[model samples]
Target: MNNWKPRVSMGIPVYNGENFLREVLDSLLAQTFEDFELIISDNASSDRTEEICRSYAAKDKRIRYHRQEINRGPAWNFNRVFELAQGEYFKWVAHDDIYAPEFLAKCVEVLDRDDSVVLCYAKTKFIDSEGKILKEYDYQIATDSPQPAERYRSLVLVNHRKHAAVEIFGLIRSDALKKTPLLGYYARGDSVLLVRLSLLGRFYEIPEYLFFNRDHSQRSVKEKQVQIARGRTIVAKFLGMGPLPPTEWFDPSRKGKIDFPEWRLFYEYFISVKSFPLAVKEQISCYLYLGYWLFKNWMKLVRDLLIAAEQLVRASYKAQKIIEISLEKRF
Candidate 1:
């Protein structure tokens, strides 16, 4: 084999995505920038996802497809794609999203020209399941700010934009992404990632609508999020949305554990802040901004604690009942 590495690595972490997979693949393959590798990690999907991936991989030298023996959850799959990537730059695209032909070319141009820019993403338009444009996302966070603290504060308030974490899909410096925890297995981890990336360097937003985010009822954020309290998670909190997802959504190993997503998100943000080396003033500003976050999310934080306590009580009751049954049977 030849030791060939592409300029950019596009990773698609998908599960049961056959329905709209073709549209995304076609869009990426048709990108004006052809010097990129496409890596797809299938999460043991029972649908025709495997067949579809194999078909595409066979035809395209740039495509690499991998299927897991069992479901490893979204976090593992998301990180797996990155581990397999050998490109100078990276981007994570959802299987259901569509991109314009200039998306990759434009993003690569920005990253190549600006060493200070850690990530570059185009303006986004939300599309329905049938590929019809629902609305265009015009709000732009100050991610391009030269001040890291300002970037952090802007991303923390991304929920006010009433859009999901679209910037997370932007072309990013592989080294910068590697410095942070690549997507944690907690609710709203993507936002945490963007904030961390911003701390590393600047973010550039192209002034064109080249990215399309498909909003469907079956999407994970919508489907699993509804199981929790509405308007509580990062994606939904702005709309008074629900709380974190249950176990096994992000990682299967964390099954049956009490998940305090809001609290987890709160703690992760602090960890990101502590991990980065900022000026004393910048660090203090970040901390101060976090205090504002705490005040705003105090309700969600309280809910997390209450939820954990309830789960503990339920677990104790179940364990006691099981033990009683075993003892009675022995007698």
Candidate 2:
């Protein structure tokens, strides 16, 4: 074991995950790759999460545990873990999820063998709270590593339909990730970060189910909603067809309006130059998506409103019945 080479750092961010924490840590300890270090960053967990992590740290020399003074939120905690990582490759392990034994070994092998591939994610199995077999999830797997243009195009159209970004299966180049810090953007930070990762290099997919993602009611719906909204904004920005402004409006040098990457630039290019056909295609795709989305969301809003109305009526009916029964008893 002393001769083992630590090529990968497995980062697991925990916050009040006491119930499932030990199981996750146990899985990592049992991994076939024995040389790696497990960096467990506890984000001020109020439960026994800290105790469990400390116990594991005492037991295993490779387990490095750090508890934040305050809760930095999930995104910040995740970023802290990655920034703290000191390995050639990094993998984000969710506090509640479990991994197959060969996950690390296989992922490391992929990154080790391939210099061009910067990311490699595999199929995941959805498990219940008790770790029971639920189902295999392979729907998010994207087969080909298309050019950046095609990648953005597919991302705009189909990213949300894919797997959880939190699973974070890829073996990331530590150097490349340091360039794209995961700032707590409202939504789609993961998507934007993935875009940054893609810009660094290509991505590969493992053809097996080596990760287990837990599905339960405790999932954060607010975060998901924010992610969806951010995804829409990103896609719209890319499909808009004009050069992107700098990373932010505050940065100057190329100020006002500079040509953005063609892969992500909006249709404003043809509009500015008065090229009729190209401008029309841009306008058509942009508005068609806009209209389709508005109509779709409007219909969903109407359905939700109707359901709320039904629930309100039912509650009112129950209240009236209770009042009538009380009056009848008094009479």
Return the top candidate by TM-score: 1
The weakest ten consecutive residues by lDDT in model 2 span 263-272
List the pairs of residues colliding in candidate 2. 240-266, 240-267, 241-265, 241-266, 241-267, 242-266, 243-260
List model 2 lDDT by residue over 166-245, tens digit each: 43556788877776655332234565566556545667777888888887666654445533442343333444422222
The positional error of residue 162 in candidate 2, measured at the CA in angstroms, is 5.2
| Residue lDDT tens for model 1, 154-243 | 988666437578899999999998898898887677888988999999999999999999988887763355466433434344446455
Question: In angstroms, how far off is 172's CA in candidate 1?
Answer: 0.7
Model 1, C-alpha of 252: deviation from truth (Å): 0.9
Q: Please, what is the whole-model Cα lDDT of each candidate in the order they appear?
A: 0.87, 0.63
What's each prediction's TM-score?
0.93, 0.66
Q: Give candidate 2 regions above 4 Å deviation.
A: 1-5, 140-143, 159-162, 221-331
